[model samples]
Target: MTTWKDFLVSASTDAEAQFDRLKNRLFSRLDAKKPYKIVYYRGFGSPTAVWITGRVLRERDLSTPSDNDTFWQNLLATYQRFESDEVPGVTVRVDAFGKSNTAVTDKEGYFEMTINPPDNLPPGRAWFPVRYSLDAIVQPTGEPVIKDGYLMISPLYSQFGIISDIDDTVLVTGATSLLQTARLTFLGNAYTRLPFAGVAAFYRALQSGPVTTLFNPIYFVSSSPWNLYDLLIDFFRIQGIPKGPILLRDLSFSPAILSSQSHHTHKLAMIRKVLDVNPQLPFVLIGDSGQQDPEIYTQVVRENPGRIRAIYIRDVSEDRRDEDVRELIRTAEAFDVPMLLVPDTVEAAEHAASLGLIDPDTIPEIRADRRADKE
Candidate 1:
């Protein structure tokens, strides 16, 4: 009884419905299968809900990008980035010191809760442990599952701390170059990635230095989004960078600011937060010459006065930016904070050695690692 046009319309309607179903599935993928397993980011600050957060995702939806991934694998990784799954609207309970706090996940399947510690908490240990338990969920196939996760609390006690950038300063990310940066970001996974030569040993020496002692806290404050948290953690583990809180930019991907997400604002906000949290401890500012490190560190010195002991910026872009760096270096003379623009990791080590931030013997260790990496 239907005409050809009606048949075509019915078919078209069915296809649209199918597409809509697919889109909705992508949004609720983790929720439909399992209660999201919590992925915790290290939290700083204390006394108040020093703010703890982690993303929940289904196990199978997680992608570990490798530099050696084939074309298809890379494509899958790209999908993982754009179409990643998150747990949503579920309540999570966090337990610490016999007290519990509750929070509900966002549409992105992320949750945050600040468990209060006792009034007279001991600082003898660097880390205190907390337990997380998620509510049970039913999968489409009628399977039930429950997830448990743990978090560590870093207590503040160091004389001086180090806030370093990760992209170019610690890891050899091609951030200054758009094409190269995109290539490295999209194609490279944590395992396939590499660290800047001699950085690990240099940082370890600083951590174990006479100035700050063995447990000096190091905060890797990066402008990169939080989505790469696990990959960055693996990179640090492989490179032997000392364990510390890694504060990353929020990839909230908020529709309002996607067109103008300011990296400067994010990094600056984090640096200020860290400084504010540990008012008694001075910090060393470590960044690179690539983007805004020199400028930002200059501002920090100007604003905080004597709080920053030194600024060490690795010279990753010497050819075109020597004059720019020299200008920043010269300008730093106006402030009490010393700034060192080093040509190589060894040079930075030497400066730190001279300043007593690290041992003099660290210079030789850095040289050896540099030689080994070259070979």
Candidate 2:
């Protein structure tokens, strides 16, 4: 049952080992420092359980620690190889919701553990109080990183789920423009990074309805690598956006078969993984016309018919593709899926309201957020 990802992990582990040996031979003086940091990604699960993923690595950038964790610097560092070495063969323990799961980190220092509770927990957004610590016997230090991991369990009987792209649809990554994308990447911090106008309010309305308890799951799927996971989490909070699982690719510049897949392939796999996790929950796919979102979402609509509740495509005003997007619109129309080639967040929100997907009153919140951006 070996998978392509597993093969890639194995290959990457070998390459990392070779790099470490070479480093040790040249810089033996640097070996005195102990490894004591962990990079954990928030995970999601159902009402009765949750799953968490993380990598155990030493704090390599201890010289320039920031008040905000300096994720922007780490994000920039991801472009280089061997930024942080993985502590493999480490015994990691994860405890949450009165349950515990133990697993060993692979050669990549990555571990995933799922914890199931005794009963179904409360609906809406909830954190299971996750705590992880490396086994002292194998660790160089006893320090443990404490962070709250989020798991959004959609109301068992709620409406459709949402899996949207982040680059241009939610935040202005300028992904379609090379110069703009590089500038934003190197120059912008998470706090300064901008979300598209009204996107936050629209997403919030979708999560918490007019009655204010609707908890349909909303997921942010992006081509951005895992290095920016924390930054995106901060971006969601500062912008008043509804919180959900952020699934990102592992854009590790390594020799791996899994890395060979196009960005769209990675996204499609993640979307399908979400669908498999929530079998009964139909989805509303959202993305932009910036890149392959239109085409990728079209394939989803075709492959998984009737399960798609709707589709929303935010048009890139800079590179507005009428003919290309129109072709996608026609494709969605043929399948009877409600699709929109929207110019902005306000228009998308209004269209969703008209379709009874959200309350008509949600438009103001979206507009207010847009206005705040201008101010």
Candidate 3:
């Protein structure tokens, strides 16, 4: 059942991996030896299972962001992120929940693994910390690289989960416009980039849910490349947005990349993975209408009936796209999932409040934050 497109994609992936191998070998001989590090990404799961992901790369001496950073400095830092030297074919290990599991980095130096949840984890606690280290040694070896990665664990008694998009939904990337997107991607750092007005308060409210202690886990599923993962994490930290596992796509170049299905494929796969891990959790999906969020979310609702409590699609597209989103809203409604096209975070918060998904008292805080962001 393999088509020509599939063949091309496989061929391109193999070719890219081969090229990376050769490049890594050549660089190792020419450049000075550098220490390797394991950059553990945040993970999430329920009480029975947990998922973790991270990358292994040569430690680069990039400049950290500062409040008074210059444009050139930000641009330089952004450039360095994309130019990261990945250490492929390296084994990674995670020791958590009284279990040990190992995985190897692929051509892109990324590794993902699923491990069992802690045996005696408390019921009310949300975050679980685990130790991860390099299982196998590779290149300029020094001391062993061991780091701690935290996973967001949802309690069985918690409220609905929040699955959100990053670029347009939370951060203002101007994703619909290529020029603006490129400008921000290249010239912007964590300090320079801006989140949408009231996004912080609204997301916090969703994380808090109806009950203050519910602590519903929020997962950020974005179509952005993994190279910008650190940058996005910095943005979340700075904007006071709730922190959770950020599932992002690999920056791969293939014949399939030319097709629009790539975005849908990546986003859908991540969302489904999240839903699968937390089987008992119902979710509220939040995204923007700039691209394929509406369509993809509709598919999610259709496939996982009753699992999605509601959906909020922020209006970031032209008037023409309005009808498309409205159609999706109707489609989602057929499954009893309330999908709303919101003008801003306030409206979405209002809708969530009415649904009892979030605290009604948080509306005033969202409005205040919106005004402050505008000013």
Model 3 lDDT at residue 43:
85
Return the candidate ranking by lDDT, descending.
Answer: 3, 2, 1
Model 1: number of backbone collisions: 2
TM-score, predicted candidate 1 vs. hidden true structure: 0.82
For candidate 1, the 10 contiguous residues with the lowest summed lDDT are 252-261
Point to the candidate with the largest TM-score.
3
For model 1 the local lDDT of residue 266 reads: 75
User: Which of candidates 2 and 3 reaches a greater lDDT?
Assistant: 3
Model 2, 200-272: lDDT tens per residue?
8888887765455677778889888776776677778888888788887664535442454568788999888
Error of 2 at 327 (Å): 1.7
lDDT for position 317 in model 1 = 84
How are the candidates ranked when ordered by TM-score, highest leading? 3, 2, 1
Tell me the spans in candidate 2 whose CA falls farther than 4 Å from its real position.
Answer: 1-17, 20-31, 60-82, 123-125, 137-141, 144-148, 254-260, 317-320
Which stretches of candidate 3 lie above 4 Å from their native place?
1-18, 136-141
What is the C-alpha lDDT profile of model 3 across 99-137, one tens digit per residue? 789999987789998888757888878887788888757
Worst 10-residue lDDT window, candidate 2: 60-69
lDDT of 1 by residue, 1-375 (tens): 987755665666666557546755765653564434566777555534355677666645456555566867765664565454556777777666678787888866778765566766677555656666666655456554344433433455555788999989998888989998777777777776778888888888877775535566688888787777877887888778888888876554333224233677778888997787667778888999998888888878878888888889988885878788778777776876789988778988888788878879778888988777566
lDDT of 1: 0.72
